[model samples]
Target: MNGYRFYTAASLLLLTALFTACQKSAPAPQEESGVNAETEIIPEPNAGSEKPQLTVAISVDIAPYVMKNATTGIEVDIATQALPGYQLNFIQLPYEKLQSAVAQDQADMALGVQKFKDVEGIFYSENFIDFVNAAITKKSANLKIEKVADLADHKVLTWQDAYLELGPEFEKLFAPDSPQRKNYVEVADQSEQVQQFWDAKDVVIVIDRSIFNAISQAKGHKLSEVDYASIFPEATYFKANFEEADVRDAFNAGLKKLCSSGEYAKLLKKYNIELPNTICDSKAHP
Candidate 1:
């Protein structure tokens, strides 16, 4: 009986020691990873609210900005990083359809929109990037576009809906009743616009500055041989219209965070996109 009691006490002591050791051996909670912490999300709108997945509308087939083959682009990267809490649903469509997606309540935000002026039930976040536009001509043509009116005498090729996207001033200049409308052609494909310009079908092609540079580099256009008329002012791109104001506000907050954290610069580097002076200027205050 005494031996049995001794064994029981010894076993209890052993169990106690094991419990104490386990308490000491267990790991404390580890700090969140830098990337995870950096991307730490704020819950959507109201607490305990179950928000539907966010739909982000982007124009399809816009390379480097909205890639045709790849799932990611500059705007996609920014959106993904900025809105970490919501399950992003990208609805890729044509330029016109993209805006309609938001209007029809089919999308939460429209990516890469220049402006939403005069659009009802639509709001836009702070401008995140600038779309520098220009008029390009072949060296042989020597066509000069000193201003919007200068393009009246020359055949001009530009992306679809450019008249509306370029702002009210451009709208008036490219109005249906305006004589410039006779020579004005809005193409659906940017590649075709660049090709048409290179083929010398038009006197001038209106395109985004960075896009023109990329196409020019690929086609082996000599920098000295091509003239880019810096006529149009830069257009500011923004996240336009979400179902809820809080959602848009959250994105604005996240965008500011992204800019301040230098993640915006990193994204531009990753995509090989040149940082425009407009964006660079925004970084100063961010």
Candidate 2:
């Protein structure tokens, strides 16, 4: 009778041990978060992403074009989209400092660089952006401006350097030597230009459409009541200047790719910007 009781107790102990062992050896319950799943592959942050940093110089004055935020706007975005292989770090300086920064090696590249006659020691990329200048007038004015010459009939307002920029025909007509030169005013401040245009209903402003819209709309001006005439040629191309020729070539290639893939147009619309002329409009390779 004692052996039988002892055997019963021993069997119970053995069975409990076996049950605990089985439970311990069983596969872990599936995690609700799926972290332990066999198929889940989570990438480590910054894994194998050792891209070189490219310091780009940009204008601080041009709002909506410069560094509007930490990682957006026309100048910052254009460089970011154009150079995917390298990380871009933009240094916002004044308009005059853009070229000097690159020239002095303060930045690796500069946006909105133009190849001036006397400017040297810079590698310019293919014409990447067009400023899209136009002859703006009031919609109710009924102005017939099919060409640059027609602007002679009305008061013209333009940027300070418009004479050298708006082609020889414009230079001949309104830039200089016109008896109406007093009526054709060129001011350095474009914000003033927009104000002046709206202040005088008959005034025709020679300005970039995007810039005009940017300034005008910000000042609570209604665009539906405005009219623009694109008389200027799309020759003035915007380029990125680089310290190295190789980098310039790389940027050109990337720009071409963006245009081909149609991402360039999408970016333009994202910023509510457009090309001055219909010739390329961020589509052409050149």
Per-candidate TM-score against the hidden true structure: 0.73, 0.67
lDDT of 2 by residue, 1-286 (tens): 9999999999999999999999999998677674655666867778567888888887654545653533667667767888888988877765556657888989999887666643477788877777778888898888888898898878888866577678888887764677767778876556777899989878888888888888888899999988878788764666788888888889989887887887877777887886644324535633
Q: lDDT of each model, Cα atoms only?
A: 0.74, 0.77
Number of clashing pairs per prediction, in order: 0, 1
Q: What is model 2's C-alpha RMSD?
A: 8.9
- For model 1, the superposed segments whose C-alpha errors exceed 4 Å read 1-52, 118-121, 167-169, 219-224, 279-286
- Among the numbered candidates, top lDDT falls to 2
- Among residues 3 or more apart in sequence or in different chains, the pairs in candidate 2 whose N, CA or C atoms overlap within 3 Å are 132-276
